[model samples]
Target chain A: MTRIGRVWRKSVDGRTAALYLLPSIILFSVFVFYPMFRTIYLSFFLTDQTGNAAIMVGFENFVYLLGSSEFQNSMKATGLFVLYTVPITIILALFFALLANEKLKGIGFFRTMYSSTMGISVAASSVIWLFMFNPSIGMFNRLLGVLNLPQIQWLLDPEWALLSVSISTIWMNIGFSFLILLGGLQNIDEHLYESSRIDGAGYFYRLRRITLPMLSPTLFFIITISLINAFQTFGQIDILTKGGPSQSTNLIVYSIYREAFINYQFGTASAQAVILFLIILIVTILQFKLGERKVHYQ
Target chain B: MKKLLTSSLFWVLILAFAVLTACTNSDSKEKNEPTKNDTSSETEGTKDDGAATGEKVSIEFWHAMSGTGQESIDAIVKGFNESQDKYEVKAEFQGSYEESLTKLRGVGGTKDAPAITQVFEVGTKYMIDSGYIEPMQKFIDEDNYDLSQLEENILNYYRVDGELYSMPFNSSTPVMIYNKDAFKEAGLDPEKAPETFAEVIDAAAKLKTDEMYGFSMLTYGWFFEQLVATQGGLYVNEDNGRSGDATESLFNGPEGLNVFRFLDTMNKAGTFGNFGTNWDDIRSAFATGKVAMYMDSSAGVAGAINNAPFEVGVAYIPHADEVQRNGVVIGGASLWMSKGIAEEEQEAAWEFMKYMTTPEVQAKWHLDTGYFAINPAAYDEQNVKDKWAEFPQFKVTVDQLQDTIPGLATQGALISVFPESRQQIVTALEELYQGKDPQEVLDKAAEGTNRAMEIANKTKQ
Candidate 1:
């Protein structure tokens, strides 16, 4: 009887625990999960002006999206954006993090400066970069002029618009990655470095053998975030370029914005958004799968 | 375990409190009412014994004006609120034209939108087609408001099939803005601005000096629209500027080619500062006096007149040698009344609408914003006349509109997919600016535009 009573109490405790998690689960379902499901569901249907009633159009939106040259160009641009931003942001963040992590004078100031950019919103940073990149009166061209080089259309030339946007993203995004790397660097044991030094290991050899392997987990984290962010790039394009210099600066989200808001193609835009979400999801999963093998918990 | 439980309980209580607060806030806050944050809300329930009133009628007006515009709108709303105690009108600034549209659209339900909203000229078709806007003629006829004083051209942009959907608030057309300092630097008299296409080209060539271009024009589709309109050409075949059909893309003609050729010529002559990506860039370039002359919206005058480092001279946009000067269509926003408001609120809205269109209000708006007075009588007002004379550049837009032809193309076509089509045109222009042949670019653009139009037509009811 006592055992049965204990079992009943345990069952009650389990229910209580579920009750504790119920609100968050409900919120997650309502806000995040439901919207995600709705996004996927709406992607397959043609919605009316009010977005309430929809006509069942199986795969037509996807087909149309696939056939669209604009969509194709946007996909290509997004791919290039990912390629440019990921390596550049990670490398630049690492460089700053390494420099800031050094046991030198004013290291705290350098650390603060490196991480300060994380506080600026992407929209605000884009506006600041727009001023900085103004072709006629920008600081960039003035510096170029001082070097006696010809002025270049940073955001106006289709060939350079993607790269230009990438640079702004780099400057705006590096701080967050830097913080992650700095955390990873701080986790490395000083004893290992001391032992390596006592055993006649040089700085470069120790770094390659110990630091990189130890930091792989953080690198993986940054890579995942950078890739996701690069794919979801919208603010810089919307604020700085507005997909201009002849549609060369357009990314996935900007095209989605144009489709849903400006063009009122809600269904098509939803389809595009779903496609992007899936791509990000697949890439992220792949990253975790690959990164899990390299991430030494110890 | 006790600490964990306490913290968990604390968070749960906090979340519950937040959710409850949000719910109450939303419920008390009237949804879809235009003047949600109106002054009437703050005034509380005060019974004025002027007319029959149980619960006081309050109407919401969402506009994109702050600063002077906000102050003026507030004064007008205050006047309406005080003049009669039966109804209270509230005016709220809802950020930019794009932002207002986005907000209105985001709150999709009928009960969540503002009673009245200010949409830009390009969005007239989109707003009307969305079936949210109530035709102004209904409010005018129902309430017996004076309608005869409204100008025809000003009203024409808001009409679809002879039915008015909105009232013109701040109407402006494109005109040439020149820096007098830059003009003098180029050894040209600032007073003698170029009046013809040939002269503009010649002046531009002569004005090209160290790091300065004689002329720069925004290469957006609006410029092409204005160019085509000025040359006595139509952008759309039927429905003029108000068509629901999307499969009828027609900007690949001689006139469209001419626009490209002209831009190409400018580019080759180093007359453009490579700032044709957007309107702000063009304005900022002209403001800095790096470009001697710029063809942009006259509404942009307020920004330049107040912010430009040098004095600005406004003039009519130069026309082709054969065609005479014709006015460009207005580029500013208009006010639309949304559905789902109470009869009392609608009446209050009409009263506010009439107040906005009155000569005194419109004239004040024009003088302050560099937009044209929608009421022709506003021009006759002594205050408006004084401002016009004080800044001679303000007269250029008014004078240009006096000779407007309102050709099928010049009327500014309103289609469901015009914004997309405009992008297509810009894409083509970009290609042309990159040295591609005008004919080829137009043809390709027309093809792409036709495809977009097909999609729009398929979706249209």
Candidate 2:
């Protein structure tokens, strides 16, 4: 380390290196640590209707959440949502990234086109999708009628609501995932591809052997990020289905929001949030442990 | 020189923060500060004199209203501010009714809360329990204000223990809106709107064709609440919590079952298209002639008139054949004054509230927005008289409200957990439409609502 960077060493200098780290340390403690501990504290209480931590119920909120059939349904729904959106996003983004990485005509335009959805906010995109998913006069139904296909009850029916929301989420997430993959793809050494081709490797053969292996680190990052985001799905579900058609789209975060803001049960909401956190934590840790073996650092 | 550079970098970081600490607590920041807190409950006003040396007290007035409704509110605030020199009421659009409450609750125990707020009817119990509100009765009694000019049925919804809690500002009742062109095409009497669910089903058969539907209403909880009341049934026990605090919900009764059955049968026959709680879509559908007869807030009457390609007809919210149509509960929202503000500010809010309900202001509100004026006297105003003559649809809500027998059921339930209860009912209604047994859904929903009410009641103690 530079002498100036380590100036705070007690035996060496009077200047403190801790000064530079103070802002981030303070911010992290205030924003992250405080809310985490506060949520744990709140879980032991029963919140009043105005969401005040009123009565100390001594883990009753947690107990209730553990037994709540509705909360269980939300967990199942969130799992389905993650399953539906994550792989689809990764695959499509990888495909688009591969396509955009080529030395084709006007490739920058295609790259811009692929990544353009990154500019759209969740609410705005959800509204656009809402128009497409409307039961009666939606674009999808109109297209179905024209093609002589059976019209789907996109948002109204319970069977299709989750899929409908997932379709929009996948579409929304593809841009971000594509950008990350593209960066990873660009960083790959050209000589490796050239050598593989010279070694009698076909396009598919080289892709499976080299491209996929090298893209693992980016894939790992995108997978975990999208997984966390999918678990936190709210805007699309709220805007499109409102967790409705018999709670088909009632993801955990939306449920937590309702418990906190709508039902004014801060304790229950906090309990639910803690449960969701633990779930995400365990899943993410498993991903990291598994991914550490698979991902190539260089 | 290296030491000087290192020390200078440290000083630069400190200077950057000094410049970055430039804060502007603009009115928007003041408006939004309450939203930062975990508590979504509002705290009352902290005084800041707008002008030095006895100038007009600039008190903020927050509302959930937007669109043309917001324009109307802006006009009202402007009128009030101009009419008096003592106070300048700065009206701010907080958000939707639900968001406004969340923001209000989030701003708990802070001085940033607006002096007066617009809260929906379902929030009555919660508002009272919060103790942030200064009851309208306090100011009314202190001034001996004449309350008789307001419609009793409309006023009853806002009253707690025979004392008014909030002033009904812009109120509405659920009314049946129909497409007259479709009705005429179906060979049904276009003017005679159906009064019972059976009659609606009968009308639907005739109205059904290759391109259009006869009925549709979203699985909106408010409609379910109204349907329960239209049958002279209370949603909760203990006289809808007017006579005493309600301990349980009563929506699983035979009346409730029949209402569900009626909706179910309509769904089964493909006569009633369930919109599934998107009122905006259903309203647009009616306007575009996709649906013929649908029940919507009386507030939609104006939108229907303006937007519908064909003629629009209105009637009281349909009832069951065996059930007596007592009345539909008021829907829209009311104005509430918060506690802990200065007396002059409180009085100013009262004056503004009174001004808002005055015959002229009420008439303007009714004409501009589809919401009915709470003041019965507003109907007598010449401008409203002209509006009634021009668009007879405007009187349907007022007449429906007047015909309503003033009972606890029609007055609406006074439950603090009504929002959650409403959400549960919406869930139940959606499940019912999805072909679940209506009785089972209602029972499950009722149990959930009852538990929520019990929790709420216990908390208050």
Candidate 3:
């Protein structure tokens, strides 16, 4: 009781600190926290045409989503999308980062080129990809025609839609990951590499032992961000396929948008959103618990 | 320390109050500013008009027209503003039909809503049930307006329970646009386009070649609904949802199955071009000769005629072999007035709508964009006749509309959940192209629509 009282007294003494945090608290409550709580509240009820909660069907929205084939398809698509995009994007970005980190002639140009895709907005890039994926006169099909090969329906076939979206997503994401990893690579101590070289360690051996461990913190951060980003992907899916070819590319975020905005079924949309939030929360928590041990802060 | 804590708490509360008040004050200002400007403009108009006593009511019109349609609308609005000094109609392009409707929901049933909004044909039921609209019949009755001057088939889609809910504007129907050059190259009659599903399939097989597929349709729900409607098929129960609330989807009947099977057979025969769900993709494919025949909006006929290297032929959308063609439901948007706005503003909206239906304006609209003039008398105008003489394909669309049988099927289905149901149909079409069973996919789509309708009914306040 004494300790608790002392803690309370200590907090009261830090009223100045509370004043400092008031602005952020107010902003967050208005923009983020309020909407998040409203979404949770709305998840349990059906909305009318005006989007007001009109019917109370507690947990029915969540129950319906669990049993819905479309929602299940969305989950599967999101999982496969994460699987397809994250690793390939990380490794490819890492490769580009390593190459650009070296001291070579016009290396500055190379770094800029590697990170150029980050300059393009997702909507613009997705539009460009949409044209390239066109079945008739697209670059891909024309190239295939030139090679006398059977053309692939890049965005049309049910089998290829998700993969096609993931391919564009990976391309769009690589630049940011590459830039960050390059910054981390540049921040590593030069003396450590010099000492390793003096020890007669080969380049690959040093890369495996020194560079990776040194880059682990950056890698961990990128991985967590990329995982969350893949789950929330909407623009590319909307522009490229629009969850078409039999809903193959209907990622969770796009499905939520369709339900809430297009269908005006806010209850189901909010339930799906809540499920997505929990999944991301669990994934992030697991990452911090299990993956953080491998991260080298120094 | 206690004094510091108390002072800090007071400061914190003051800051929070300031932020909250600022947000609310700005919101109210935004809502009030338009009406303030409108009132000032009205007083100015009264001073100008002198004895007329007409208060200048400026009403915003939200439309989804783009490209040439937007250009035409701007010209028409300019004409309306200049023709009358009493009402000033400001036309604003608000993205696509779906997007604009979504925006309307934010301000719907409130004074903040636009006085006039152009909602698509599928949104007819939704707008009527939305409680945001003032039915056009009320205005027609008050003004003793002649509603018979408008095209009955076009007005039929907007009339609910024998009362016109909205003023029909920029109406269109689906037409099968074909490449005449491709037809000749395939040794088929260039002028005689396929009229039935079986004939279309046969034509498609012959039209198939190394460079082009025989047939294609933009996998859109509107085209599917048109195809089903032409077979005299009810999209939902209860007289196509015109009599009472729809409880089930009737689109999975034999009529829908036939249409799906038609596409399925063509797809299996490698004659159907799958251009995904984009309108531009399929349109471009048709223009580039990648597909010989495809379903397109009647309004798109002019563009096809201009863009395609080959001669374009426009015909009625095909129907199943066993069923006589029952014509098409209207597919374009209509102008709706808001109920909550000031009476003078509603009066302005009505005046604008009346001006829109004038033969001169409708003629210009039809010539500028290929959408059918809501007032059929616009066809008698010299400019439309001159344009039609140069390009007769426009006449086919008009004839098709005039020939439509006035029945519940062609009047279009009434359901607030039309957009959701259309999405279900789109998915079913995509699956059918993926080699899924025709009946199975059709039934699945029906079930989806049924569930949506049920939920909509249950949640209706």
Please tell me which predicted candidate would have the highest DockQ against the true structure.
3
Q: Write the per-residue lDDT of candidate 2 for residues B1-461, one digit (tens) a residue.
A: 63464345434433332222111111123443333331112122222423333445667778888888999998988898778667668787887787788777865435556789899888888788787888899889998999998878888888888899898987888888998888888888888998898999889878887667788877888988989898988898988987777998898998799899989988888887776678777876777677899988888888889998899998888899986789888877888888877777887888888888888888899888878877878888999999899999888888898899988788898888888998999999888888899999999999999888877777774
**lDDT string, candidate 2, A93-173, tens digits:** 999999999999999999999998999998899999988887667899889989999878888889999999999999999
- Name the top TM-score candidate: 3
**TM-score-better candidate, 2 vs 3:** 3
Off by over 4 Å in 1: A1-21, A52-55, B1-55, B66-68, B106-109, B180-192, B241-246, B309-311
Residue A161's lDDT within candidate 3 is 86
Say which prediction, candidate 1 or candidate 3, comes out ahead on DockQ: 3
The complex in candidate 3 yields a DockQ of: 0.33
Score residue B253 of candidate 1 by CA lDDT. Answer: 80
Instruction: Output the better candidate (1/2) by TM-score.
Output: 2
lDDT (Cα, tens digit) per residue for candidate 1, span B1-461? 63464345434433432333223212212433442454454345454443246567766778888677678778777877777666676677777675677777865337656778888888887777677767888977777766678877777767777777888887788888888887887788889889777788888888887778888778778877887778876676565546545456567787777777777788887775668566777777777767888888877877878779888888888777677765677677888887776667777777777877888878877877777888888898999888777777788788888678765556677766677778888888888778788899899888866765666555556
Residue B164 C-alpha lDDT in model 1:
79
Ranking by DockQ: 3, 2, 1
Please, what's the RMSD in Å of model 3? 5.7
